[model samples]
Target: MRERAVSGHPDRPGRTPGVTLPSVTERKGTTNESGVRAERQGTAGRLPALAHESPATAFGDYRAAFHSARLPMALLDGDGLIIAANPAFGELLGTDPGRLTSAAAADLADLGSDPRLWTAYREVLCGRSDRLRCTRRLKHPAGQTLWVEVGVEPLPGGERFLLTVADSSDRHDLLARVRHLQMHDPVTRLPNRALFFERLSSALEAASFEPSGTGRIGLCYLDLDGFKAVNDTLGHRVGDRLLSAVAQRLSRCAERTGGRGGDASRGHLVARLGGDEFALLVENSAGTDQVAELAQCALDALQQPFDLAGQRLSVSASIGVVERTAAGTTATGLMQAADTTLYWAKEDGKARWTLFDPERNAHRMTRQALSSTLRPAVDRGEFTLEYQPLVGLGNGRAEGVEALVRWRHPQFGTLAPNRFIALAEENGSIVELGRWVLEAACRQARAWQLERPAARPLFVSVNVAVRQVWDSDLVADVAGILAATELPPELLQLELTESAVMGSAGRPLQALQALSDMGVRIAIDDFGTGYSNLAYLSRLPVSVLKLDGTFVSGFRSQEHPNPADETIVEALVSLAHRLGLTVTAECVESAEQAARLRRIGCDTGQGWLYARPLPPERITALLDADGRTDDF
Candidate 1:
């Protein structure tokens, strides 16, 4: 079989016409030296018999093959005008084959001046590259959008170029749909976490390479307040509807604030991270001021009531806004900071936005780390005990010591009880921690007893939390610890907060009475801080009342004396003594306050005036020195 001879159209005089070749292999990956030759042969063909036959007959055969070929093919002149086109190319442009001839190849669709297309066209026209293949969006005259893969190759015998287009509408559409599903939330229809991270990373990358003004970025991470309660009561259907509504409002807000075209960083992109959490990424942001305005807008939009499931429900959100230059920031760092700030908003009382503060976040992170490490710290014996002397007001002698628990944290050094006690309680680890303190205190007290057998037995008081009283076998634990340490019950006092004792009713009340009857003295710690039930106090077997530090603080300015505080303290002491309960004034920071407490008939005084908290060896030394001083 002779190879098909390609010829140019006679009407378009100096142009080379293209031959129709057989179907060839689809080009995948990239084009190389051999691939370019194959592309020209596959789409245009050889013009071998052009020099052998007459122009008219050769042109006739070329025209016959051009018209007969199944693919959409157009033959362009040196000036990029389509001198001739196969019927398939004409059909693709929604025109007749005769009408398409001599029209500018670009004028067939809206892409005549597209830079990307023209750039490749220039490269082929100027002999810089062999062939150009690109995917373009073309609008057909038949009122349908078409995605076409175009191939531009230099004609073999003239200054003309060959342009072949293959319909890629189905493949492009399928790919686009897959991308949309992956990047979007099905219910809310907002960008999901994956796309948000992608865009954020892209923006950060661009900012890193750009100049100063374009380098700043911002993010606002938000969570709906009380969404769990709504979901639990109304069902998931209503919750989903509520989420959709929120998404719509957020989208509108982003659209209103978003910048157009290439000013992408000045634009807002809202996304749903999952569940009730949502985030907004702001590119090329004007610092936190811009982000703050966006957060306020989001809050206002969510403030409106949602009509879901025939009920009018209103919800508020907590937002954490972060803004910084992209030079040293990362997607993970920004998100973690946003998460931490958002939690601060929830903790500081929700329904508002909070800005990121490094100091506060560090403190919170430390607390969180401590909370997570509490049980393990206990297991590792990282906690130790310190004793504060409880001196008798009459004799100025250290009668007993209150055992305070401290964490010998490897990183933070020794931490006081105030730093981590509430954290322990909140995480339900206080019961175990309290038991450890009790056993340790008992063992220490027995050590002191054996060290000093002649002097009066100095009692040790251990504070117990309300959780420990109710959650554990308090009486049994105390019994076992005492039996193990060989510490007498009378020599170990259990200090319960005023709220703990006053709030005790059924089982807690029983537990307190059982321990009190077992010869464990019960003292009300921080007496006036809570609701002090005077009448209820008589019903319990209470041995002592620890006056709150507030009244002791008043005694510090006794020169310009607060007569009312004096009257209150005096009255409290008189009333407690009448009920057969000893009164111990706490936080006695001055000799004057100590003298005032003694004058007011208070039994014991505990504070910095006597001594700050000390280790066991220091307490023993203080006791020995006091004994030697009494001899003097």
Candidate 2:
């Protein structure tokens, strides 16, 4: 191949293309109309773009055109020599462009000191490819490194190559930001679900190859207890502030306990699973006890309420901790088990910890599997209704029976509400369950009215979960149920707990009012179980207040010493009466308790002693006897 000399200037040009003029040219004396070659090296102000000029005046216009290019450029010869260099190139390499001539482009690049540069150059010179681009940092004279991306193209005639360089420091920074956003949660800046799984999977692989005796991975799934209470009490804006603060605490704990400070085997990853659920993935755990200890640390850390947006808000977590040698079980199975155990923690009591047990996990799995069938169970007629009689406090006469929901499982025989009501609430199947209870109880009340139509105008009290009240068409469902059973609104009462209406803002309050307006009596069931603000009661359209079983049961228990129970009950009774509210006392087991309740001014009562919740037939027989039973 032939080498072409890059001389576009002609009028004052001292050299011709491929002339190979002698190094010093005693003839030209290193000076001409082109301008005196300085005793020391110097370059014109800017690098020019020669290829864009017309060849006719190319030689005359080269110098002007060369001053406009932004990128540093240089021309390289076949012998790896820098044939010509621009001012920008001189500034980039920290050298005078004139002195750079006859120096190899590799020498000017400063990468010539590295072995890799030689290998890349060798390949480029061999015509393996015409272009080369790479990102590499080179030492500069300023005691700093300059990051650059270079593009090299084979110039026509095969002798010279054009090199263009750009500084990519800013671009590199943007790339880092892009990666972080992809791997972290936008709101909390914690590792997202994607990154957590990646780290977990890697840890698992390492655990498989390592000896079993070494250690294992620990997973702790923590869900914020009563987070919904906070959201319902405050608002989502405050809830978000609380969540961010929680993320900070969790991240700090994860960093402190993940592993050895300087080792990869001890890394921990913490992530938010959306909403109020957060998870921690721990590596290199010694045993179950160690995992439990870590869980305790987490719980203690959350004991201090988070101070956010000027509010001292308390946050507690129910954590399900699981530690396995990563030998027997897989990650998915382990997480599922941990999650199952977490529910047990919440079920046992909020703000607690529970370790995964296979037996408990199996039971929870069965329960979860059964929950999906509950909605369909309603349609299939697998439900039954039982009524417990509500007797008058003074007369001991059965007033009306409260409706209780029971599910008959083909396999489990019969399931109680406590068994599946939580599940139904979680899966939103409670809407159907509530409606069924309504219809069943209303019909039973109608039947009782048929036998004794004037017997105190018997009313059926049906318990409605807060979820149902918030989810279903409450007024419509109750109205339809009563109309269908030919029962009046007064004959079918809806029992709502105090907490259900305490912070009753938004649609829930409106729903309650709508049901109340339909002439259906609304009662606050389990009044004192939830620490409700009693002032809200005066504003509610409630007709009855059922003293919670706990308050009434404490009246006679020797273990508890509280005369306030009776005082509070009497005061509530007085308040109920003053506010035109009837009082229904629950858990009336003994004749003494019933008599005491009546003495305290209770209008109605229900318990095992008042003819336990019986089948429809038992209820009918009682009504037929017309309160003439020998037991009564």
lDDT of 2 by residue, 69-183 (tens): 6677876544455556677766776766665665545544543444565556545655666777777665566655667787777765454477766767678778868977887
lDDT for each candidate structure: 0.80, 0.73
On lDDT, the candidate that comes out on top is 1
Residue 514, model 2: Cα distance from true site in angstroms? 5.5
Task: List TM-scores for all candidates, in order.
Answer: 0.76, 0.53
22-75, model 1: which lDDT tens digit per residue?
123433443333243233333333222233456457566577787888899977
Task: Compute the lDDT for candidate 1.
Answer: 0.80
Which regions of candidate 2 are displaced past 4 Å? 1-286, 290-321, 325-327, 338-367, 411-413, 451-457, 466-470, 502-519, 531-539, 557-562, 628-632
Q: Which stretch of 10 consecutive residues in model 1 shows the poorest summed lDDT?
A: 1-10
